[model samples]
Target: MIRQYDLVERVKSYYPAVDESLLNRAYVYAMKMHGSQKRASGDPYFSHPLEVAGILTDLKLDPATIVTALLHDTIEDTEATHEEIARLFGEEIAQLVDGVTKLTRLELTNEDSKQAENFRKLILAVAKDVRVLLVKLADRLHNMRTLEHIRKPESRRRIAQETMDLYAPLAGRMGMQGFRDQLEDLAFAELNPEARDAVKSRLDLKQEKSRDLVVRIADEIKRRLAAVGIEAWVSGRTKTAYSIWKKMERKSIALEQLSDIYGFRVVVDSVDDCYRALGILHGAWPMVPGRFKDYISTPKGNNYRSIHTTVVGPERERVEMQIRTLEMHEVDEFGVAAHWFYKDYVENGSKKSVSASDELVAPFRWLREVVEMLEHDATSEEFLEHTKLEMFQDQVFCFTPKGRLIALPRGATPIDFAYAVHTDIGDRCVGAMVNGRHMALRSELQNGDEVEIMATGQQVPPLSWDDIVVTGKARAAIRAHRRRAEREQYVRLGRGIVEASLRTEGLPVDEAALEVVVHDLPASTLESLFEQVGRATLNVETVVRAMLVHFTPEKKSRRPKIKGAKVAAGSERAREDGTLPRGRPDAIPITGAGVGTSVTLSPVSLPIPGDRIVGIMQPGKGVEVYRIDSPALAAYDDDLDCWIAVKWDIDADEHRQFPARIALVLANAPGVLGEVATVAGKHGANIENLTTTDRKPDVYEMTVDIGVESAQHLERLLTGLRGLKSVSSAKRVYG
Candidate 1:
């Protein structure tokens, strides 16, 4: 464990203006508060905080951060309170300590939910002052280093998983590659020891076989840079076991097939020298195709900048390397910890302190976005899942027409692009123009692609967008659009229910009673009260009961009735859910949020009279009806609140023909497709679309979309196709 004088002197070594007395007081206070408390490691609890402070000192953080690390666990684990910390240290250090402290007292049902809630709080705290994150990361790093001391295997695995899932990615996002690698490797060892051992054994065997390979590669790179008169320092090392295992899992390859396991980092004097050195290496070696990325020109959201490339070097090895300036390398390694930066453009190379610039604050913008998203800014249950996925996903940066950059996931579409721009833009998105040409809204975006959104107010979000969009924000926006659009219908329906209840009570329909009820119930306004009633989340008799106290008694023609709590549910009939042919004025409209047109069955989902169905709102196409069990509904699992609850109102629409698609594998003989078409036509099904692909010399695959009356008709057609001698396989397709 680090002693008091040593910790204080270490902070003063870099930050000379540090307060020695403050550090001494904090150290002693932490020690006194944690008296006789022992860690699972059987060490005094004070040693943990001491080690955390030592870790932060290596990062060269501010005095407040180092001091906050020393006392981070006090408010949570010991008798020391936030007020006491504030009284001893300043409010800044106290707040930092509070932010680093976890909310252990929350009554969450399970470990996962508790973990999510804790992470949510951590992000909010980090958003305020990044020093909180610095202190917390150091705290977690120390805990992970001593994780083996945790006796329970379950506890160890849980902590290790949390570190791998959240902390490691966060460190990488903040550009702390060194910290991220160490955290990941330690966590990987705990979580998957067998895989870790397997990777480590392979790495060791390779190292033993060619121990001097990395040294030779570094020397060759240094010599190549020097030949062009560019000064550089090249260092090489093998990747961590966790990193290699991750690559193996991602590429589905074994350790033997994996190339580019070794990496080199080249640090140069200036940006010009960095690029010049990159040119010299590429000119001397054959550059590997599709393996170059220029983060130097376009820095990451975390302000990470470097040029990464792979080349078949003089040793004929697939070697990966990164070229960056000394400053860039420092930021890449230390991230936000390196406070004083931007010495390049300053005259005479005098450094200026800028601890609160865009470079420092940009990475935390993601945390801010996350906080905004958690409050139903998007979907609720899937929000945490998407949040975790975003932490692990590599980002692809694209540009808007106005030159603003928008970063999204690798397979993100134009809809994802629109949402990344703004939620309103996503909701109103109609189409997009990629690189000055019209493209489909579901087009996958690539890095550096200039995209332009074509939006109109009349266009509400399409439910099909849930399938194509990859961002959580876009999914949330899509779900919110339907709920927002339903507010008016809910209000209207609720008003009728309220008026009916009033009529049953022999009272006149009046808005005056709503004011009393709104205050009496869980509603902020009369409209919300009506909305709750319409959605059945609030009972109508409850609304009337609140009004009875304030209502003036009028003459009643009928007095005796059933008890208020036991009103008959089947008696209430609004008849406003149908929209067939406009002949019946009392029919229920069955209208969805933005869907006013006639409902149509999707060609892909093929929902029929006998199948359970839902209405998914689509732009221009009304609510697209889909079967309840379709695979395409998987994306809408989080968006189910937006689905219009649908039921079969008729046996079948006589005039409507539902299109269903089916696939077939058949012997590629003379007339297989023609015979299949004839068989389908005989069953009263019309082939709307047919496409065939040659599978082999003697076999073929074909897809056909046919208009049928119901699932029965489609099933019959499939049966006939299977009976054919040439057809080997025939199956109906949904989704």
Candidate 2:
């Protein structure tokens, strides 16, 4: 059992004026309540809450937040209720406890929902009151620190994955570099054990041999700063396990081949002193070329500011050096908590404001942006995949015409730039000028490009624009546009289907008729009906039948002539011939057409429904329903035939297993393939083949063809596939 005195003593140290009597009574109540409880590590359950409260104290949160931390698990795992908490404390304290309590009851069906919705809830709760997030971060930090005690391999993997995807990124967003680094190290230790061990062993060996040399270097730097009448502190340390893993992957170097396994930090008194120290250090050791960054001038999007330089030490061994002020160092390690720690100084006599530092504010903005992108009803897999991509990004600093810096992810193009500026700019973007020169909207932006967005009133977002956009923000906007367009199309189609039925029943079809039929239904129900029609769930026949029963037509309206054409037949010969053109191919003769009838724009590798698309067509492949784009046929524009008017194949006697695409985004490890194969078998999936391709650093993209009965089967299989520790996304291959 954890001693009650320790919790009270820690609280007293932070808040000498606090009421110790209340804390002692609450401690006694908690100890008795959790007396029989134990953790996965077999520690007393009371220890967890006490430790959580201690962490809250370390973070310098208010007393209410600390108390909430102590009682967070009580209502969830014990007999206590929100009312009970409110009765014991006040409403504000109970509310805080409730917020922290909500973080635990997450019901995630898939990994994506587990990540996106959970984090979405977490961040929005934090945004309301930042302290809730601070305490939760502390709680997660401790859980990660002791994750190894969890016996099950699957449980360990899930926790590690959750840490990397949710907690670590959150810590980074909050500017808590120390906690973020430790969480990442712990996660890497569990998820990629071999890489973690290799990096740890190599770093240990380097530290064993170079400890004396590093100490001497630090001593010399301290002496030099002292002689210059500048008081400072210097320290040398090996990189964390996660940092080492990233470096090896980034440089594509083996552990034994890694050169810079250590870093040296110099903490000074002011920003000027930081730069002065950097200059002094460079004078002592030759600076490495192209290894200097002055973040103080242009801070990271995460709001971290420092001056970094790499230099050659005594034996010409490369040593990375970071210089910052003591205040910067404090913020660097503790993030926003440092402000609370020094709140007394700032409030009474110190020369600073008590508000959050810019670093704290900046990360919240980015985190909110990410949360917005993820909360668009995106599937858990997609949300997790895209969020990971965005979070793991390396920023590129581009400039607007006004010389304002706009930081974006590396590989982000001008389209992403326009979207970043505003949704209106993205919708109206026609072209762009980079550095006063015309450039393609898809051109990758580089550092320091003074880009000017060129737009026309006639411009609109293209459905295929998402294929070229790299950022999650841009993609979310594009998806929103697509959803709107789809809804509009369904509304029009529903109107037409309703009108035709009313006309056949001798009733004049009008808005009044629609109102009568939909009188009892919500507006959303009408919208959903239209969507169902668009997706071929409720066909025109079904809509007509429903309308005929509801309305009577008054007069006949002239109907357009229906074209009569033979439905093209499909055969295995079509697959073998490969005559169905796709992907930038010239027009070819379609044998099914009448003599002298022309067929142009034969899409290669795309299945056109009416044209008897064989293996040449794919589910997602956009193929021409018609050979050309026409304004009157807006429904069929942009590979119209690719939008197959699919109906229920009621007469089909057999359930066919069509080839569906399964992509695995996994950590490239030795036994990962075997593990994935085992899981696939467990989930009743027959993998036809698997092909692997390397993506940037540690992750690989593998494609596998699997047989599935329908979309639901595929969803279940993909869900199982993603449950594998390393797999990122699993979905059908739609072109």
Candidate 3:
């Protein structure tokens, strides 16, 4: 346990004029309130908050923040009241405590909706005062440190998973690298103990073999800088076990193959000295190609700035070096916690409240962007899904035509760029010009490329756009628009159905009768009632019964059907070509919708626009489109109500790409894969994915997924592949 005097002294060490009395009072209050309350670990609950405060003290936060950390859980777990805290301390301290209390009460569970709703609250509360997040992070870190003491394995794993998903990434986004690393390592230990232990053992054995390697490297770096008349400090850094494990998973490499594991950091006086040190080091040793990045000129989204390079240095070892100024070093190590200045200044004889500066907001741009997604109407699960998407991606920085920088995920497309700029632009995006040349909307954006989005009111976003866009904001915007479009269609369709039923009964669509129906049902408005009726949640007969004077069960009503070909999908009546006929008034005409997380094309069958397809409505998921004759459709055959008739709405002149798959057997020879890529490129198709399996020692069997204009385009590409000397056989794969 941290003593009250020790806690105050620690704060006073950084802030000479901190309010020691306020902190002391809070410490005593929290301690007494948690009297006999115990944690799952059988320890006094007071110890948790005290340790959380101790953690913040290490971060060098303000006195009020420290006090808030002490009392964060009191309002939720104890008899303490916000009003009492406000009376004892000040309103600012009370409000800070309240904010953190709200976050603590949020029990983020395994359920995505509960977790996402809690995360939403966390973001909104932290956006008001980042200190709340700081307190919450410290609290979580302490809990994680003591996680093993809890008896329930499920509870322990749940907490660990939550830490990895939310707190760890949240810390990184706020520029707290140290906290992020610690949280990740702790969570990684719980989630994958064997993997973590394996990485640690490898590191330990390597350390045993080379006891002085890091020290030798650090000393050599310092000597090199000293020779150049640049006074500097050099320190060694080794990747954490979790970090190494993540790299191994990402690159599919083992610990023995990792070269950049041992590294050094060179910190100098100024930014100019940083470059000078870099030049001297690179000139002294052979620099590794394609391993250099200059983040000083263009900082990361979190405002992390450094110059990273890997080189063949001392003893011909593959060593990594990070060069930065002293200020950058402090900012990199401590992040936003290095600068927590809160003071009450008197202006015009009145106290003006001042917390963190707007400058702090710059590093947290990612947080604000996620919160902005709420306005786009994302569901709870979508909020969680998109937030993870926003958090876990390496960034590629690009520019607008007017020279404004836009930092996006590495594989982001112009659709993502447009959404990042503004949702209106994304919703209306029609085409793009990358670096002043017209590029496909699905083209992966490169760093430093200047993108010019060409949007028009005359164009609606194609369904295939969903496949290319990577950002959460972009996908959420697209889905929101699709929902609105679907709702409008349902409204119109429902109105027609009601009008037809009124004619059958010889009644008119009068306001009096409709209003009665609306009031008697679960709906609050005519559009709401119609939307329900159209979605089939409420039957047409149910609506008609509300207005009938003597409604009886003898008169039955059925769902209105659109007039068209009544032939069931996947039935023997389909065309001989196995393709549905083009123009149908009844069948819902649709273009190729991209694969979805909630609802998508069946994995067993990848259908192009020319294939006979049907839609299956999943309960929680939106709609799953599938090839009619696929074996996977057998599962849904008994339940015809779930089936929806649909047809491709492709125009003959439109050259949009649809997803298709092909299987290939190739002679195992040099340059065979290269030849396959060349053929794919020449046929105007993008090879989205390629997986290879070994048939025998001399043969390679692979599946290739390509985007093409239609089935004909795939046939032409197959013809080109069959002509290759390396390809033994090629055939379209449907499943």
TM-score of decoy 3: 0.76
* Top-lDDT structure, candidate number: 3
What's the lDDT for residue 170 in model 3? 82
Model 3, 209-307: lDDT tens digits are 989999998898889889879998998978899999999999999889998898788889999998999899999999999899998988888778899
Question: What are the models' TM-scores?
Answer: 0.76, 0.73, 0.76
Tell me the lDDT of model 2 at 255: 79
Runs in model 3 lying further than 4 Å from the true structure: 38-43, 510-513, 548-735
How would you encode candidate 2's per-residue C-alpha lDDT over 21-81 as one tens digit per residue?
7677667667777779999998888888888788777666656667777887887888888
lDDT of 1 at 350: 75
On a 0 to 1 TM-score scale, where does candidate 2 land against the true structure?
A: 0.73
User: Which residue pairs show backbone clashes in model 1?
Assistant: 378-476, 575-588, 576-588, 576-589, 577-588, 577-589, 577-590, 578-588, 578-589, 578-590
In model 1, which range of ten residues has the least summed lDDT?
579-588
